[model samples]
Target: MGKVTTGASMSIDGYIAGPEESGFDLLFQWYGNGDVELPTGHPDMTFKTTKASAEYWRSLIENTGALVVGRHLYDFTKAWGGRHPMDVTTVVLTHNPPADRPLADENFVFVTDGIEAAVAKAKEIAGDKNVGLNGGQIARQALDAGLVDEIGVDLVPVLLGAGTPFFPSLGVKPVQLEGPISLIEGKAVTHLTYRVKK
Candidate 1:
């Protein structure tokens, strides 16, 4: 089995998305922004070193075998046009599955049970590859449940005064994190990786 990882890009103030109902365009502007090249031979490298930050992001998506996302996120992105950007199997957590019963294909699966079931299914589908937990709420649940092995955050310089936080409180005990396995400083955002201390 492989590790369960979660990642997101948040503002300097730690907001993942803008105020309630506000879109995430500004928070995710780095996606469409120009490329960011990093220096060679960084000591704290985790994954394969890349010349450009965009390439690093692409590599992450490519490496992930399966993904778990919340219902809100799934609906917000319009199911990524019925196909995920990474083109990998994705499991969506929701209390209400579609009326069509199993509305999934080789690309997506909707889990109505809970986050644990979703993660289990994702791990099964992922096999030896990594299972990516996307978005804030779902990531929080995974962390609270001790299902995530690593956390990576792309810290953007901008600060959305009022917005959704990247790591919301789960009302559970604090979770400790270890060494930033990697730190890629980019023109738009800085990527930092931390292993969840088990």
Candidate 2:
């Protein structure tokens, strides 16, 4: 079975997202229409020499086969009211379904009730590849249940103290670092990776 991975960025204050996350929205603000998109070769974008960051991530996402994300993140993605990421099937964990929802695009699927069910649905869709843990709560649930295979984080600079964290307090389990590298984009941004030790 392919490995399930969780990825996110955090701050020096141990916050995955900054206070209010108002600034967090600006995390990727550097890359937009007029700005110079950081070179794909830049270390921050791609973690390894053999793989371009975008390609690498696209591969992982393609391999994902399925995805499990919390409702909040799911809603946030749908806010734009257009195409969502992960062309593969997605199972959202939530208690109540929203009144008006995005139409299913063959790949989009919704699951309510609990975390285990969400993972099961994701795995069902995953087939041979592994499932990807989408957000903080979902990531934590997968980790707590020992379902996640790996965690690839892209450490960014802007710190958000009040917003949701990448990994909420998870009973102090030890996470050993695997392959890590620092990639620099133009001047202020950096991308880092860490493979969770099981």
Using TM-score as the measure, which candidate wins? 1
What is candidate 2's lDDT per residue for 1-198, written digit by digit as tens? 666777665554555566655555445432332333334322334222222444445555566677777778777756324323445666778887666775334455667758877888777778889888864788887888777767755555665657777778785487555766334332233455456667
lDDT of 1: 0.79
TM-scores for all candidates: the values are: 0.87, 0.72
lDDT of 1 by residue, 1-198 (tens): 888999988888878888884637665666656635322222332232334667767668666889999989878877776667766888999998767546677868999888899999999999988999985899989988889899888888887887787778875568888979988886577899899898
Off by over 4 Å in 2: 30-52, 79-82, 99-105, 181-191
lDDT of 2 at 69: 76
| Residue 74 alpha-carbon offset, candidate 1, angstroms | 0.9
Pull out the clashing pairs in model 1. Answer: none
How high is the lDDT of residue 89 in model 1? Answer: 82
